[model samples]
Target: MSPSVAFGTDIDERTKAAEQSSTDVLTAPDVPWNLVIWNDPVNLMSYVSYVFQSYFGYSESKAHKLMMEVHKKGRSIVAHGSKEQVEQHAVAMHGFGLWATVEKAASGNETPGKGGRQRG
Candidate 1:
């Protein structure tokens, strides 16, 4: 009679642990990100305000306020969201001929809508 060889019994347990760890990583919540608009000499202030209004559906006054912030402060965090969302906003701003960039919210110098309606 041939002897039966026993394989390692912990293989399935190890696999399940590995899978749970990977799942935890995959399901982790996205970190907040900011969409920053930079002041550029090319785009007129009115155009920047217009873009803010039309694209983000901001009120005229709010748009103007943010535009002024960009003009005076040299930059403004126009919106906040997940990294992917902010990246999309950056692409749209680029399409509008605006200088825009995304950064982790924690690293940003200012928060979006410091005293106004938060746009996310």
Candidate 2:
């Protein structure tokens, strides 16, 4: 008797089901991800803008806008892509001495904006 008969299951059918499950996992829907840059006291605004431009190859205007967002808001979504991509971007940002994180894009609003502060 076959092992399937011993286990009271159709071995071929079970194998097919397992294969389908594996295929489903491989072809699963794509979920967006974001690279969030957080504000810190150490870096100057010009340096942050330059990092954004040099690292992302963003234009001066765009880099300035993002830097301002980081200053006015507590954090900014600097990049968006697959989980691995965003994670890499966050790591690159950290390498540039910036605080950064990677998180799911569509799950919720991760941005926390604090009113702009006057630093004397």
Candidate 3:
């Protein structure tokens, strides 16, 4: 039998390569973005909370807390993820009649394009 087959060298080498590849993938950094929801007079608190629950799948308590934060603070960071994801969330909030925007969480700066839209 070949030395590789007799001693499981092939399996060992494959395992080492797999571990290295997984480690490289796991260590890669990702830039984050934040979806900020602004309080608006047009949306009721319950409706805002409902939107949070429905869109984000957050529990009632979590949605209510975030909604209250928006109410009291004028704005709240409702979600965080990749720029595309946060932007999508902001757009969904817009569809719900809530003022929302997405900003780069890494630099704490707003991204370009429709990220800064507000209800007129």
Candidate 4:
């Protein structure tokens, strides 16, 4: 014995629409991402600044400024780039023992420092 299922007249159209929407979601354009460093009790402030300098090639003053932002504000978006680029930065930050994360840049928000400065 088998049960039969009925299909609605709009089933094909609905399926096509769903497929298209899924495709759109899958192929969505990549947006700029931010590499945010979060303050933590584990890492020293000097070490954090060093990571910013050595990793991102930021000047001593600029690195110290960003480091202070993290120390005072609890987090700071230190770099901005394509999703892949920021993700790679996040991984490198982790390797340096810094708490870091990547997130989509908020529309209209100013990114810290010169935006999209590629790591040297």
Q: Write the per-residue lDDT of candidate 4 for residues 1-120, one digit (tens) a residue.
A: 111113347645534443333233223364467778998888999999887765555667778888998999899988766676667667667767789999888875756645323222
Which model scores highest in lDDT?
Answer: 1
Off by over 4 Å in 4: 1-31, 114-120
- lDDT scores of the candidates, listed in order: 0.66, 0.61, 0.60, 0.65
Ranking by lDDT: 1, 4, 2, 3
RMSD of 4: 16.7
Off by over 4 Å in 2: 1-31, 107-120
lDDT comparing candidate 4 with the true structure: 0.65
Per-residue CA lDDT of model 3 for 1-82, tens digit only, reads 0111122446556334433332332233554667788888889999998876655555577678788988997888766656
Per-residue lDDT tens digits of candidate 2, residues 15-60? 3443333233223355377678988988999999987665554557
In candidate 4, where is summed lDDT lowest over 10 consecutive residues?
1-10
Looking at model 2, residue 89 earns an lDDT score of 60
lDDT of 1 by residue, 39-120 (tens): 9888999999988776665667778889999999999987766666667667668877899999877753565555544332
Better of 2 and 4 by lDDT: 4
Alpha carbon deviation, residue 95, candidate 2 (Å) = 0.6
